[model samples]
Target: MWLVLAFAVAGGLAQLVDGTLGMGFGVTSATVLLALGVAPATASAATHAAKLPTTLISGLSHWREGNIDVRILLRVALPGMVGGFLGAVVLTSISLEAAKGWMAGLLLFFGFVILLRFGFGFRLIPVPKNGERTRWLAPIGVLGGFVDATGGGGWGPVVTPSLMTVTRHEPRKVVGTVNAAEFAVAVSVSTGFVTGAAHQDIPWLPVLGLVLGGVCIAPIAARLAGRLPHAPMGTMVGGLVILVNLVTVVSLLGGLPGWLDAILIVAWLALVGRLAWRAWEKEKAGRLAVVGNPGVNA
Candidate 1:
């Protein structure tokens, strides 16, 4: 009972962050589930499935707000669908449990990426002209989808930053389009996992709990998308990624102390306080890198 409640809380928090920041639901939820002894395939499947509703609502909201670029959606979605399915099949064919050490490492690496990219005043290449065919979107979509499925969550983290910094599109628009595209990625990954090795592996109870929690915050998160101090949430979630995965890796080594779990709770609380108190200073950093900088692709 307590375990299921924990999963629900994690799922809700994960979606809240993803809804505002455009990533983290799958990464956060999958990490928790994996740490709880859920099989990797099952964790991936459940996380994607759980994401379906939240993404749908969040995407629709973004679209209504004119934050999505239809052309980019088509370009990314088509390839992303293919990559998501293939990735699911490929992962199901392998022994993900046996490879969890590598999986933990992968999540940890991305955790750092999120921290540095979003935390330390990171910027990237200019956005390509609207629909001018950078020729890079296709491959990136494919690769992002593949990684998303295999790792349980990489689409937003993998794709969002690249699109934001590389293309110089409006950060909000890039975020919305990536989120809209996630609908397709989530669907494809879920379907693939359902028919693949994890067909019977869905944790219905925990998934339902997560779904309920996520649904409660979907609308609120959508509204907060562009308005919130995303970096703080980004940092918070990244901290969770590192903290949780680090614990998982350690447990793999030996029995983890009960006190360490208590410390993690404290660390999380401290980060939240730090983020809230530093909001003004971080905002001065201009994390969004405003739309018209004269260096854009248009």
Candidate 2:
């Protein structure tokens, strides 16, 4: 019971973060559950299933707000779904420890990318104005789908930034489109897992707890999203992704000196606290901006 409650709390927190930032629920929930002795396979599968409804709801909200780009979805999500199914099959056959190590490395790299963005502002990549850039969408979809299937949550980390670099859309629009695309990927992957690997014996209590907690608090996150500025919100979300990835990597590395772990933990906490404070201030300022400048729709 205590364990179930803990999982529920973690899920709620993850969902809150994801709802506001457009991603991370699966990664957070799966990482926590994996640490609590759930098998990696089961953890990934259960988290995928548990996050389905939440993603759908959040994606619909973003769509209604005019965030989704249906053209991109058509080009990207189809390949992503296929890739997710293939990735799941591969994950079932891999050794858990090896998968964890690889996932850790990927997460660490993602973190490094975020930190780079923080230290140096986003470096815009020049792409042909013509639709040739969309040619990359299929490959990105495959990679994002594979990562999400293997790591439990990587769609945003891999897909959103890539799309932003190539497409150069507004930050909020990018986030909303990513969330909308993720709904399709998550649904496809979760459906495949449920049908093909039902024998894995998922922890239903924890899954149910996560689903309920996530669903209940998701609206709050959406509200907060509307109240925040795009640039700062992107920065905050990117920073959190990096910090979380760093922690996951360090934990997976296992043999780091105790002092190093302490340092990493402290740094993560400080970074997160600072980002949260900045976000709060930005939200207040954004609300004021919206009221004062009626032209600013965001």
Judge candidate 2 at residue 66 and give its lDDT: 71
Worst 10 residues of 2 by lDDT: 115-124
Q: What tens-digit string does per-residue lDDT give for candidate 2 at 129-199?
A: 66447778899899888888877777776777678667756665666777778778888777667666732
TM-score of each: 0.84, 0.78
Candidate 2: stretches off by over 4 Å = 1-5, 114-120, 123-132, 194-199, 229-254, 257-260, 271-298
Supply candidate 1's per-residue lDDT for 150: 85
Per TM-score, the best of the predicted structures is 1
lDDT score, residue 231, model 2? 42
RMSD of each: 4.2, 3.9
In model 1, state the lDDT of residue 272.
52
Judge candidate 2 at residue 274 and give its lDDT: 77
User: What value does the lDDT take at residue 91 in candidate 2?
Assistant: 68
Model 1, total clashes: 4
How much lDDT does candidate 1 score? 0.78
